[model samples]
Target: MTIIRNIFHGFLRAMSSNSKIPIAPVGVRGMRDLDRTKFSLNVILPVLKVREEKLSKISNILKQYFLKLENFKPVQAQDAVTKCVYFNPEKITQWNEFSEKDKSIFQEHNIDHTSFSLQSVQLSYDNFKIDTIFKAVLPENEETVSGFSQIGHIIHLNLREHLHEYRHLIGQVLLDKIKTCKTVVNKSNIIDNTYRNFKMEVVAGTEDYFVTVKENRCNFQFDFSKVYWNPRLGKEHERILSFLNPNDVLFDVFCGVGPFAVPAARRKCTVFANDLNPDSFKWLNHNAKHNKVNMNIFRSYNLDGKDFICDIFQKFVSNICDGTEKLKEGAKIHVTMNLPAMAVEFLKHFNGLLRNKENTVHVEIIAYVYCFAIGDDPASVAKKMVSDNIGRDISTSILDVFNVRNVSPKKEMMRATIRLNDVIFNELQEPPTKKVCV
Candidate 1:
């Protein structure tokens, strides 16, 4: 019985060894990591040699059927020939196809097929596009990783649970494919924390978090793990800055690394930027200095949103109203509350703060409050939230309901620009009676 058991065990071990996952065969051009998880493909295309001077004419004639592979040069030197043009494999499978199916094309173009040698060229994994490589390697019917936000040298991915198993493989592929990406991170946790910075793990490439990003012709460097930076907000930032004129005042309640404040300061706008995150505050100052923003026009603070509004914001407006803070002619006060998740809740503090001083303040006050909502009418939903928090129906004061970006399939990041008119600041006082001409 013992001898029979040993024989069975040995047989089982042999079967297991034979059933081990197979590593993919080596690629033609020495592609790396061609294994069961990472794979490669080989493609062949038709090629023909021509003189360098005729390259432009031939390319123009066959531009529709020319190889469209990105980062690929269809024209190359072939021995004594100065130029060789490759055609799409799908259009011309073999040299005979050009003579048979595509014979009319040559006849129409008045080309001599016998003058040029018809040859087939092979392409390796190195020649394939990033998307093609991903589609070839990833499992069938699986959701491939496509969208990503590039901040500086880091690629941020909010991958779903289904991609968890292939996280490393996906990271490796991205690091290899993207030339500017030095680090790839996956954020698994929700961004509901106090500082709004999500915890992320470095899936591939270097572990460095410090990176410098350029936006709106300004440089900003910060620690990625300690602060929040979204590259997709570039257009929204530009849109907000468009409303500001020289000598305008900006009060950024949730400024992160001075995306709005620094650029506004450079544009000669007096900026008072604040954020609860200490790292963000530190980088805001750094970026301001780096971008050579006028120090006289830029100020940063690390304070709670409510405290900043109560102390800093209230005092600034009070100074403006009391004539203590001098302003240039046509200067306006623009408040930017960019904390989308909970910025609407802070709108209540602005309600009565501007009361009784509306007449004293000469310039207009516009509040750009950002919020996230999910519905068919997300802009209206956001407007209602702002109106409910401020305790006023600001339908007439609504300047613009801009859809900043789509946060999800149904959720949107909406910006409601509300002018601080008599409805909000004056607290519904009687309208001034019109004077009849004597």
Candidate 2:
């Protein structure tokens, strides 16, 4: 009985052993794990070559890697190619390894040898091929590839690591490049040596508002206290200010961070700045005080309402003129709303403000639209104010689409200019004695 039981036990052990699947080796498992989480050195090395054949090899490797990984989606590959490494294929020779020949070629091409760090090398006996990869470290806190600030340059490289780990470093490199290359041609030189150079007062929690460089003995001032204010819009503010007349009553709607309003007021124009953001309103007041600009600024959130124009006009009439005065009686008002996209919708509303029998008012609404050519017609963007306010159609023809800047490799933001004719309301049959600005 004991012999029979031993035989049965042996048979059961054999079946169990046969049923069990073969476990993957540690090296294979490690490679799989690495493949799932990180970019492979094998894939990156070919991209460094910058040749048609090398590019093809890189694409194939990427495809194989994507297939091998359970979850690997290529969000942007072509764009990545343009950004990742800076090398001219025509001048630089293709190198399979960091051999004497490769070093000599690099020297010939003036490629910085110190920047390249060889991370790994693998040999394939079956194919008689060698794989060598290296990483290039950008300058500390620099935001560009190859130390060039061109908008979409790759500054850093990671072999077998997540792309996001080096994104900020890459972005910093790009930003640094932009700052280095950016040249503001001061035609009028308003900010040149003449104006009293004062150290900008540092407001707590507003570091982005001003840039103080002690090396240059210059402090760049930006109106940070108002709505929609960005240091990037400094040129726009200067442009508007340059065109302003001293006695012109400049009205700025959506006056973010007071970029337009502050500059206009500084130019000695009677400026009325209005914004929907409360924080911006506070900043606008603070900036006005900071810049020492004498101006009337209002903070209101309901600028999208249908009755907003009339309400604002009433207040302007009472404050600027006497209480009983009306617009279109004899008022020459230069209306300026930098929110160009929504300016068209406000035209009808502006007409309503000037309709009352108070005074004859001439209103000029400068509409700005940002856009680019789609095919033959330009692709434009404008906020339909009437659609936003009363759910009405305000689809008017685009006057002129002006290209502002390239936002991406294929896309751009442009500004369009539209004009509204002399609008007189039926209620203003008899002009009032006092002229009220709309």
Candidate 3:
């Protein structure tokens, strides 16, 4: 047994050093020597040296076995330290011979255990091998278990080599069924094209709103119409709306599909939503109708090109202030924009918007920085954009940047809030040097 333990340990150590098996034994467990002839010839080996490298192989094999399974990607490997069941010839035979009826009986009883010879053995595989077996049991409610039984052999193989694969398969099977059983409620009929040429679904009794189908972009939803703006200025909308009193004026620069405007209108706040995209402008008007709110939609473009600071200032003066008439004296304007990476660049233009205003207007300029996670530190990509674009104009002291929730897994989208004091400004300078009222 001691010799066998050393041999097993050595084999495992060598394999761990050479391969990328995710599972590794931390401490020595009891080991025993069994007849070398007892090993089954049908055992399939994992070809890949690393766990991630084997993903494609596993996907291909699973696809081959289950034709309906598409886009099968591995997420996380299950821990299999104490879960592995070593088997002798008799136990293997019993598993192989398990009838559909027998499998159903075991499932009906929710049995998760298997009786087999207990021994710790080290397994080795070639790095070039790509595919490994995965196994799962059929549900007890399954009428015809042949489909499951056919895959049982593969499952058994995975169980012997990588118990994590077996566990993953089981979870996948259950999740698939649950997902399939879900009833997709039809909200497509509620789509109204009277205001905009788009599809909208209002999940009844919830503030959640969804917009359908954008080119190179998936359908998106927001929590509130006022703050939960989508595409860019979602978080800013939420913050401004949180503090907005009823009937307050909200201005959204480059507002897409009324994420900020619609919610503000729903809250009975006057909203002026503007966007450069013709489609977005159309959708904004349509979303207002869908939500049964009166939101002013404006089609305006920031001609500033890459110089967002100059562009934003010009847009505010030419379009938002003059064209929309929403930036009136004493009117509190909650300005929302989905360009966090470029928000600071646009701050220098804020002085011009507040200039000549009698009543102190609140300007909430939102800069959404797409991050990997909700609370993760801003990645280099976003920080670089801020530094490259807005570094010279303003320091961090004058800017109010709040992290919004994570919008994507790639950290490509995040929302940051910038609240500006609505102090009256008399002139717009190349460098903004206007006093702001807190």
Candidate 4:
């Protein structure tokens, strides 16, 4: 009998060391009815009956050991007649575990240190967190789906093929856990190159696509289905904006809904924003107007990227040379090409387009070109591609090469900043001296 008692105490000690509170009930895999799927966790906790008014004071004194079970109060009615404050079982199982300081505090407060009684508390499904639910339902070896992009009221997920069967469950869990989420969608296909927007299927919640997002101190409103926007690029946008000053000139060649152009205009910089997609162009004008930047400050165009580049630069050069447009002293010119798939192909247009020895002597032009490259070193590969496309060695003129983001395990999205000065633009040859009369 004594041996059996010792073995039982040993088992209790092991359980006390390894047991976790609020554990989910088993056999709920592939279950879709979230509320009806009940889970219960029964734990033997230490309970102390106290007067109703001392509940708050005792709770504060024992805050570190206060019960953390969700949707249940730590202080509750013990029976039809009394109230008690419960302590987390994982923290203490006996009266001797309390420190001398805690004992003295309890004595000073007229509370008996030996008054704790072991009581069984039952926690239900509402007690578990989202990660606990996912772990309880997902296979032991399977990957958990937790990463998502939240844009306004929508949550965007890129679930793997293995998670397809659990898509609805995953979306429902996200919607239920995230307070601000009103809709959840998954990418149904790859992004279309021309429009840069992907087809998505609503997995849960309302199917509203029109939303407004705030970034870089600017508000942008657009239909998620008609335009392309990545919240991950917010830091990248701010990094580029940090390079510009007020009254500078910015040319956003492939501006999608004027993410860069609108902010630049707000900075007091003159902006020329263009896009090929009609929806993007319309929204660009709308966003500029909504931001209170007039057409005079932020120009909009729907021309192709190449055509826009050529037309804008030529007009700019002509304006500078002929004095039709005046630039503020020390103002710089910036060109942003953000179509990562094929922006390098458009670099040749600026080879000789802005070369004017007399007019552009004091002008400084900077070009930020984004592209995708696959190699061990994607930044070097991107720089080499930019040099090859422009028909010159831009190694020295290249100011910065940044890894904007990774598109895949092997492919990377990179940005190369190139200085376009007299060296980059072909210098015009001097006409032969005429000496016919002499």
Q: Which candidate is the best by lDDT?
A: 4
Q: For all the candidates, what are their Cα RMSDs to the real structure? A: 10.0, 18.6, 18.5, 5.6
> Can you write out model 3's per-residue Cα lDDT over 1-438, one digit (the tens) per residue?
898667556545544455422322222212122122222222212211113433353343223222111232223233432222222221222232345665455445343235211233233221101112111122223221122211101111112222222333333332233322211111223213322222322211222233232211122232222221233343445565676666455556656565556666667666555665455655566656655564343323422323333454334534443446444444454556554434445544554444554433234333332222223455434444443443332224235344564444545454434334421143223665789999
lDDT of 4 by residue, 251-272 (tens): 9999998789999999999999
Which stretches of model 1 miss by more than 4 angstroms?
Answer: 1-40, 91-120, 429-438
Model 2: how far residue 152 lies from native, Å: 21
TM-score of 2: 0.42
Winner by TM-score between candidate 2 and candidate 1: 1
Clashing pairs in 4: none
Determine which window of 10 residues in candidate 1 has minimal summed lDDT: 21-30
lDDT of each prediction vs. the true structure? 0.78, 0.38, 0.37, 0.80
TM-score of each: 0.84, 0.42, 0.37, 0.80
TM-score quality measure for candidate 3: 0.37
Q: Rank the candidates by TM-score, best first.
A: 1, 4, 2, 3
Could you give candidate 2's per-residue lDDT for residues 247-333 as a string of tens digits?
A: 555566556456666666666666666666565666667666766666453332325323445676446643443444334333234
Model 4, TM vs. native: 0.80
TM-score of 1: 0.84
Q: Which candidate should be chosen as best, given TM-score against the real structure?
A: 1
Q: Which scores higher on lDDT, 2 or 4?
A: 4
Off by over 4 Å in 4: 1-13, 16-22, 32-36, 40-119, 355-361, 373-376, 406-412, 422-424, 427-438
Candidate 4 lDDT trough over 10 residues, lowest sum: 422-431
